[model samples]
Target: MDETRQRIQLVRLLYVSRAVGPQTTAVTDSILSVAQSANRQRGITGVLCQGQGLYLQVLEGERGVINALYNRITQDRRHQDVQLLLLEEISQRRYADWAMAHVLLADDDPMVQLHHPEFDPYSAPGASVLKMVADLVAKGERIRKTSV
Candidate 1:
């Protein structure tokens, strides 16, 4: 059997949390732990978005492995009204080894702000960000630029 090169399993999840007011530290802790655990269980590694009660994530790895975890993420109890925004295979893996990495946009993480639409990570939207994100990920650089 030929060794298969890793394929990035990318997915976007738009989820609304049940919590009211601001998200708590305890909640963030649990969520982070879950991300790491998922990495161990499924060999997935990528970025996550958690803000304003929404959780968006990108997972990459062997196709079978990532798809399995993607299925599980959709059914996870932590999120309600889960809608899969996007799911597609990309040519390469984004992270070197994350198991899963996350950036909390809601809590004002500089990095998240930079990447978020409002922050304008690429100075403007469109194809530039797409290429820039790919480059950053390929270089194992976390997309967390400060915006101020």
Candidate 2:
């Protein structure tokens, strides 16, 4: 085992039932609405990526808020195959300034490889991308980073 192995993050996740089709503009809009309300309600900061029939969300906030969100998300008709990637409290909020943020994960981006893990959907790139997205959300750079 790597004695120094450590990667810390905050997160919340859910899989989408009504998968957003290839054209995601409309779906992203709908999800932003939900994410905006949720972020305000819980004082959370994070991003929601809709793609390949899934919603990959990463939220950072109080532990209780995030937990309650997970409970609610699992029951939402729009979600399925829900699995948590990371759920630890951080020293500071990651998405502190955003009401909500959305991203369309292009199929070929290095981040897209994260959708399926070593089988658990909880390993490797999925985990890495979760952290990456959280940081991107917190930093308010998601759009600029993807701009052509």
Candidate 3:
């Protein structure tokens, strides 16, 4: 193993937060830009999915970087009741290709198929949401490659 890899402790954290501001394009775009820049510098990658006035984000990076970022997120006025759903060390990133991929769960989006009328991440098991995200990303990658 490389020394750099040995010293690096990769971690992934999944959290759910309620959006304090309007979930509009202008607001989301502004937040996305800032998150991408900051995450890129820290070598972090993840996805942010918005739906039902809530935000579910998966952040993967070095332990220290993830910790600091999550701390700052907790303090951000835009997020309320920032509850962590999952946190664990990982050998590799699941969302390595994106600095911070943004996925807004619209009624017409393919991802919305996973979110039915009864489904709720806040009350449902965390693993279900993780699986949903994994499937969503996989389907997206297939479409991206085929469209190319």
Candidate 4:
């Protein structure tokens, strides 16, 4: 098959980074605003979890687009020590509903304690981090529904 006719593979990428400054509402809001606009245009979906000066994000999209986004994120001045935790080809997106979903975690969030006691993304295994993100997303959805 020709290159154009070949199927493009989808992928899910997870990464962790530390905020260069405080993890304030304005900072995260700006990041989300930009990301949502860009990601929607690029056909990407993902969830961003921020807390305690750390950012744990999972991006899902075509391989090249996802890779390019990751590259840009690593160079973004707002984030430091960006570490890619997982990158794998996938048949479907886990976060298809949101172009960029934001979950602001608190140090004492019960879900965090239930999923991972220490809740340190830097030291946690890739699979564990992914699981935590999934749980958080589910929890967010539940909260949104109840509040609606």
Candidate 5:
């Protein structure tokens, strides 16, 4: 079999959680640093977005790897009311270029301030939240590339 055809199964998982306490920049940076390294080592890639005291993340990788990571995430004390919103196999990864891209939305960001006034990611429909994240990631990439 070709190398690509013999590769392990891939899956994507999306989840949302409420922070247990205030999430500061320093804390978020530290979390991103650790997660990026760990995820890279485990063949995982994903994007993490935060706003309104909530976290919305999309992770893609091998089925077993994602499952184990999700298990650990569920047990982590920093998050509460963790909910798995999406989990399914995929032929390709959406965030394959990012080991763990992190986006922290300011309170004044339009998504949180205007369009979705009273936005609660944890309570929002899973598909909509995923679409939002996909859009945000695309925009971020465009900005990043233009600046390069």
Candidate 6:
């Protein structure tokens, strides 16, 4: 396929990162505001799960767009140690309706205890993290929807 075709290929990318400063509501809201606006225009959809100063996010969109977004995220001062957990072509988006959905997990959240005693995205497998995000999304009240 041509470069253009390759760039437009639909894919899902999951990543984990640590917050540089305090994980405040204002900080998360600011990130969502920018993400929702830009993602809507770029045709990106995803979910962001944050807690304990860590961010676990799944982004789905054109391969090139998502790649570029990830690169930018790695450089953002607000985040550190950004690690790509999963990246693969997908038949369809799991969070198609959301430009960016937010999930705030407390240290005591049950989802964290499902697979492990403590929530540690870096130590967890990519698939497990993805499943956790999926489960969180399934619980409507747990996710703050920001649809495109």
Task: Choose the strongest candidate by TM-score.
Answer: 6
TM-scores for every predicted model? 0.57, 0.65, 0.84, 0.90, 0.85, 0.92
Candidate 6 C-alpha RMSD relative to the actual structure: 2.1
lDDT of 6 by residue, 56-141 (tens): 99999998899999999999999999999999999888989999999987777776766457667888789988988898778665
Local distance difference test scores for all models: 0.52, 0.57, 0.79, 0.84, 0.80, 0.89
Distance from true location, Cα of 88 in model 1, Å: 2.3
Question: Cα miss at 61, model 6 (Å)?
Answer: 0.2
lDDT assessment of candidate 6: 0.89
Poorest lDDT segment (10 consecutive residues) of candidate 1: 11-20
lDDT per residue as tens, model 2, 1-148: 6553453445444333335244357656766776687678667776676555656677676666778877888776556566666665577755566665676555554444553332223444555756656543444433422110
Q: Give me the candidate number with maximum lDDT.
A: 6
Writing each residue's lDDT as its tens digit, candidate 4 over 51-133 gives: 87889999999999999999999999999999999999899888887888888778788877765778788888999889988
User: Alpha-carbon error at 25 in model 6, in Å?
Assistant: 0.9
Better of 4 and 6 by lDDT: 6
lDDT of 6 at 72: 99
Instruction: Kindly report the root-mean-square deviation of model 3 from the true structure over all alpha carbons.
Output: 4.2
List candidate 4 stretches off by more than 4 Å. Answer: 3-5, 141-148
Model 4 RMSD vs true structure:
3.3
Q: Which residue runs does candidate 3 get wrong by more than 4 Å?
A: 1-6, 108-117, 141-148
Clashing pairs in 4: none
